[model samples]
Target: MEPRPLSFYLLAAFFVLFVLFLYGPTLTIGILSFQGPEGGLTFPMRGVSLHWFRDLFQEQAVGDIWGAFRRSLVLGLMVMVTTVVVSVMAGLAFRKRFAGSAVLFYLAITSLVIPSILVSLGVGLIFDQLGLPVHWAGAGFGAQLTWTLPFGLLIMFAVFNRFDKSFEEAARDQGATAWQTIRHVVLPIIAPSLIGVALFGFTLSYDEFARTLLTSGSHNTLPLEIFGMTTNVTTPVIYALGTLTTLFSLLIIGVFLAGVAIMGRMRARAGSDAGKGV
Candidate 1:
């Protein structure tokens, strides 16, 4: 075999450093989370134990972590469903030219360039003016949509842009209605992409801090609660919380990826059966 180029070694070293830069902090936090009862936040482990993890379950002197987690989970699910549905609909609508389509599309994505804290503040002020309560499920939800929807719309737009019109033509040739075409043909083909959009929506909303800061009202979401904890709490328990949340985020990503894989396999099997029948 030919000797590898020097440039290849350089790129490989760069990639390794990039990976460490990305995950080194998380790895450190996970390790420190296991520090014994007497352990400090920095290195030089006193010993190893689950004491900090247990402390997480005990009464907290600061904010309500579990309550915040529950709120975040519920909000994430809400955002995921809304993002998928709205994104798919917007993608379909934009596929056909309508009056002011360009203007509307630009308006939809304008939020992407806006500062998140400004969005949060704006939404809060709107709620106050309208005699509505600013709340995590209310104003907070609306603000987060401004952030997640643009991403979801962008993903769906790309998916549909490359989508084969032949499938829809074939479905119509078989007497499928417009809704039927979308439900049976378009949706199934785009199922995996929707899962990806859902993943983005959930994860982004789960970890969002700025846009949720002012609009979440009195009830803190997990990110906000963690921020609050950082100010007052000085213990390995913080690391334990960080480790658990990181693991939960990974679990969510894993579940979404598994869903995508399952759908891919099902689609493949269906294609094979169709080929056999043909």
Candidate 2:
């Protein structure tokens, strides 16, 4: 075993502090989410109670919490499924050096760098000019895709870059059609990365605010509903909403991570047989 170095200890300390800094306030809010009905936002507990949690269901307590939550989940799931398919196809396309590939790559990059609010506003204006209605699942879906697709493409780029070409070649030699090669060979190997992209897609779409602002129009997603609560309501319910959203995000990410880990262990157990060319 190697002796510990001072730099190593310093880095370890920094990482621990960083984790604390990142999650400290969120944990506090989760605790305060249980603040008694009589309690205000900050500080000492009036009494520990699930009053706000129960109130979360009451129609008058918060405007359309369930409706907004359902919309966000639907949108997130939509983004996840479409993003995996599109990104995986795009990743396969980018595997070859073709004309204007650089141009397309740069375009995706540009979409990511542009301010999301601008995209939302531009999309809203375009709909206005076209005399089309702006709807959460319509224009808002397109807008969130602009944000998520770039990220998905970037992730796929990394995944495919490291992927071995021999798998596809072997599948082809086995008389597999292009679709078969992708489905049976490329997909299985890249499934973990795709799960990772799905996580990114769902989380980004669910939490999105700026890109969804104008385009969501008549409907509100959970995040937007919370924004309304910020001004229109004052109570521990806000903390409860925050706690709920944070937990939901954590649950989603955890499931994807577990999927990845389980897939990895399966690959490991399969050993040389799994990696061998068919």
Candidate 3:
């Protein structure tokens, strides 16, 4: 083959630099997880051990970290469910012509473009003025849901846009009611998109730190718990947690890929059988 052009070399270099920028910190933390507590910044190579991983469990605030992690997990789950239901309804409503639909859609888009800090602060102040229940007060997960819902609606809109209306029409022709058609046809057709949306909402809710700091008040999610530790002292324990989180994220991605692969194979097999019959 002929030698690549100068532009090709420049493009390759840019791609490598981009990957390093994105993953360098994560890689460093993962490596640091293997360093012992007394190892400090420099690694002795042979002196490296799994002591940090073990000590991570024995950390003074392990219980608190676990509690925060549980809270964050529950909050993520609730946000995902709430987002999916609300977005689905909003998606359907926006699919048809209606009064003020454009205005409502614009407002939803504006929410996404607006900074989370302002949204959090505004909601926090309103809650304070209204004397809302203590549980719903500033920095709480409930308030965070407001921000998640708008993005969720946007995702649902994109998913619904590609949905084939023919499926609903076919069901209706067979004497099914509107609700039945939606329950039986539309849901199955959009199942993958719905899963993807839920994952997006969960990730958004879990990683939200700035808004959580403003709205969480006395409650601590995992992000807040992790960030709180930074003020006093930094330790390899944080690196250990980072490693675990990275692994968890990889696991989720793996499961999603497996699901997509299975679906693709099923579709391919169905098409192959159909062609054989023809």
lDDT of 2 by residue, 148-219 (tens): 999999999899879899879988999999999988888889888999999999999999999999999898
lDDT by residue (tens digit), candidate 1, 111-212: 887888899888888988999888999899999999999999999889988999999999999999999999999998889999999999999999999999
Q: Judge candidate 1 at residue 67 and give its lDDT.
A: 92
Point out where model 3 deviates above 4 Å: 1-6, 41-46, 59-63, 136-139, 263-278
- Sort the candidates on TM-score, descending order: 1, 2, 3
Per-prediction TM-score: 0.96, 0.94, 0.86
Clash pairs detected, candidate 3:
138-215, 139-215, 139-216, 140-215
Question: How does candidate 2 score on lDDT?
Answer: 0.92
How well does candidate 1 match the true structure in TM-score terms?
A: 0.96
lDDT of 1: 0.92
Screening candidate 1 with a backbone cut-off below 3 angstroms (N, C-alpha, C), the clashing residue pairs are none
Candidate 2, poorest ten consecutive residues by summed lDDT: 269-278
- Please identify model 2 stretches exceeding 4 Å from their true place: 269-278
The lDDT, on a scale of 0 to 1, for candidate 3 is 0.76
Q: What would the per-residue lDDT of candidate 3 be over residues 1-278, giving only the tens digit for each residue?
A: 99999999999999999999999989888898888657764455336789778866764745477877778878877887888888888888988989999999888878777887887787678777887743423346666776787887878888887888887888999999999988988876776777777777787887777677667766688888878766754567778887887787677668767776786677567543545656
